[model samples]
Target: MTKHMTRKQLNSRVVDEIDRNLRQAFDDMAQQPVPDRFTDLLAQLKAAEDKKNSGGQQDA
Candidate 1:
């Protein structure tokens, strides 16, 4: 005899598979440190913010 799955059961299985894959990907990424490129980008952003603030001060 064959068994049939309900719609809820099929939906739950798909959700579980997606959750498992996301967890695995997160775990893999957790092993690495932030890259230098990202760090440099952050530094550049900070410099731009500082320049903006200084310019605003001069304008006031």
Candidate 2:
């Protein structure tokens, strides 16, 4: 950082740095494969919802 930089310039640089770091962190997370536990939980919820829906339709 330059000592002669104006406050606006310094603030802009800080904001840019923060935006870059956040984007990189989120991009890494997005690239990661879904964990087995998360996939299993989603599948269980879907199955439960399907069963509930079928049961409700039968009652009607």
Candidate 3:
């Protein structure tokens, strides 16, 4: 026996598949940890920019 899906049913199936794939992709990404080196570099950049903005202040 052959079963045929209506046009609307086919479209809904496609949309469901797309949504499932996207949710899984996002979940996989959320499980990954950020590298410490990246965070360290960001902190260094912010500090340097802050110092420059403060006219190289060396307040004690």
Tell me model 2's lDDT, rounded to 2 decimals.
Answer: 0.90
The order of the candidates by TM-score, greatest first, is 2, 3, 1
The local lDDT score (0 to 100) that residue 33 gets in candidate 3 is: 90
lDDT per residue as tens, model 1, 1-60:
449888998999999999999999999999989999999999988987898888744442
Off by over 4 Å in 2: 1-3, 56-60
Residue 60's lDDT in candidate 1 = 29
Which candidate number maximizes TM-score?
2
What digit string (tens of lDDT, one per residue) describes model 3 on residues 1-60? Answer: 449998999999999999999999999999999899999999998998899898996655
Preferred candidate (lDDT higher): 1 or 2: 2
Sorted on lDDT, best first, the list reads: 3, 2, 1
Report how far residue 60 has shifted in candidate 2, in Å: 20
Q: Which pairs of residues collide in candidate 3?
A: none
**Tens digit per residue, CA lDDT, model 2, 1-60:** 756989899999999999999999999999999999999999988987898888844442
**Which residue window of length 10 is worst by lDDT in model 3?**
51-60
Candidate 1, poorest ten consecutive residues by summed lDDT: 51-60
Stretches of candidate 1 exceeding 4 Å from the true structure: 1-11, 56-60
